[model samples]
Target: MTPTPVDIPTLLEISPQGGIEGRSRRYEKFLGDMDGVYRDEHAWQDAVGERGTDDLVYWVDDHRYQEGPGALIVGTSTLLPGRYGEEFAVTRGHLHAVADRAELYYCLSGRGVMLLETLDGQTSAIELTPGQAVDVPGHWIHRSVNVGDEPFVTLFCYAADAGQDYGVIAEAGGMKNLVIADGDGWALAPNPDHTGYRAD
Candidate 1:
């Protein structure tokens, strides 16, 4: 006798701060330990003090798919307004382990920038705002940086098998450039911490 398969439903609702109400995994980055992640170590200590730990920098809510293989993995991230040194608050950034898996990101609210880089050293930046959607191609390492006064919210989706390779970015000393506030606007400047970065 064969067993019957029951259909299960999953619903998710996002709040203003990019929180998805449901079963999810949250990941956070703090300012205290981000000195090595940003370009300016001096500015980081000045902005958040040397031992600041209570400040919430950014977080991601990963809604893992439980339907088995080939299911879509969805997630949302909220980058709070602040600075890591002279750089804005940002995701640690990562590349897909498969190197051929793609991802899509939709901006829910606030403003930010999406940074993309290839393993061969190619780099680009996309300005993000409310209602904007960006497709991240395969083999590209990506990160999100918040440049607004308010929280930056983004919803993203990708394949379940698209595992992340975060250590590559960390070993490379983060992205080639950093998004920073310039007066009332934002600017992209070279990251001092980025080693072996080539403009070409």
Candidate 2:
């Protein structure tokens, strides 16, 4: 059966950038009750390329957190249910040139590696597992790839102010340059920095 949409409250709690700050406070009020959102089967699989990867079966859309003339562009977690050792694509994550919004990811179950590429041609990898959360700050181009031994699931919380100058998402698809950067320079893109931001 097709997956149904999720509620606002549930979306907020499970998302990486969601939930009330302070782990201790979150436990006192939530007790890790992310409702029905599980980490192992909730993080959506990103679709890369023309044919696209039909991995993420569930999505929450650009609502829930999208507020303001409103730049609060938010979407809930997605689900990818493939066994580990198999490579998978998450989403073709994007951000506008001026939008300083932050992307948050919260892991509910399973463990996986994330591949992140910045707009300036930097790359890195991150190890993720259950009950862990990671933040993808603003002004950087990024994407999430599932490199794990088991199915990976997690929640995503997109936060942005609608009025920002660059609040749009730009996909790298069809961009021959591969990597875009300041003024007059281009280079063949390398693996993205998933663990941290670019040094330059």
Candidate 3:
């Protein structure tokens, strides 16, 4: 099949912190008929160390469904303890730029804010919880944080396919994301699954 073009901007979403101390309202949904499976905390944690010791541990779909010409499906575990038990994780934040693929984030559990920044001095923040799905549009620099007691788990659906999307990340700078190995372990700050994708 040919790759479909996506209006990535339409997918970027950000939730603001609310409820006095920003206590998030929980959201839920049943994936009874979804093609993906959910793995628990133990399995998620074990896989992290095996892959690269990720502090932002989460489960993933690997691949759920194809939306645009390219695609990505990710599932988070829960947020890690931050100040006063707020969940959070900080990656190379400024790295891994995509070429027109929309990045989608879903709050499976916990409450938190999605923080985004760019190398050019632009910044954006969003708060989200269960039952909400936010889209991180293409060509923007971004990252996320979990701010609730439960670990922050969300699904990431990529706009571009693995070969062209993750590849560039694997070949750049000093940091990278965690990916599955031959038997479900993670690689140590390994290169991205694919390369050469850039904003157009």
Candidate 4:
């Protein structure tokens, strides 16, 4: 049998402050893009009024050489510190489009939380500081929450074919819990608006 051809290996310069020197793509999310992301509609609207829709909230830089199932996508997520009422800043969050795809997230700088949940109501929230990481298994819907005063930066890798189903969270009225301020620290509060997730 013939050996399969392999793709050329590439060197990546990853920044703890959030970037990939050889990144092939960059995606940014602004305050205006987070219309229904936050549970506090009133506070979100107030923030939009004060900060304007152009305010940068978070951005991602990723590198991918191939789109095949066996390929991998590596990236950095930078979430700027922010608050909408008592809630901290967060990624829009998603489950993999393929459902069974997994992901890994390693903290590069600042502090944050990896909020994970299943369709049947199981949930987990892991706090991460510089050098910490989370291995998110398949079937989990995940989101990143910035709980520090500075930007939360994380290095992430996942299957190239995972894609993303961001609408799952929106359709469920946000995740099951919210990462919010707790004195000078952070804590999780039940998201009153969550209506549970649906696989469909």
lDDT of 4 by residue, 1-200 (tens): 65333356789999999999988899999999999999988999999999999999999999988788798999999999999999999999999998899999999999999999999899999999998999999999999999999999999999999999999999998999999999999888999999989854
Error of 4 at 192 (Å): 1.4
lDDT of 1: 0.79
| Model 3: per-residue Cα lDDT over 1-200, one tens digit each | 65444323223222322111221123222222111111123443444435444333332223333444544443332334232111134222333344444567777666656664333334456777788877876655555554455556665556435223323332333123221222322122232332333443
Q: Per-residue lDDT tens digits of candidate 1, residues 1-200?
A: 65333224568787757878874588877766465666676776676665475567888887775545677778898988876556777877888887898999999999989988887877889988998989999988899988888999999999988898877777778777778878887888876677753221
Off by over 4 Å in 1: 1-7, 33-35, 48-51, 197-200
Structure candidate 4, residue pairs in collision: none
Best by TM-score: 4
Worst 10 residues of 4 by lDDT: 1-10
- Give the Å error, residue 67, model 3: 12
Off by over 4 Å in 3: 1-59, 64-78, 83-87, 91-97, 162-200
Worst 10 residues of 2 by lDDT: 22-31
TM-score of each: 0.86, 0.46, 0.45, 0.95
Residue 94 lDDT in candidate 4: 94
Could you give the candidate ranking by lDDT, starting with the highest? 4, 1, 3, 2
Candidate 2 residue lDDT tens string, 1-200: 65334313332334342332211121111212212111222332221222234323333333432234434444434434332112243433445344466677667655554445555654555656787778867655554444443445566556445223211222232111223221322123332322233232
Residue ranges of candidate 2 with Cα displaced over 4 Å: 1-58, 61-66, 69-75, 81-87, 149-151, 160-200
| Candidate number achieving the greatest lDDT relative to the actual structure | 4
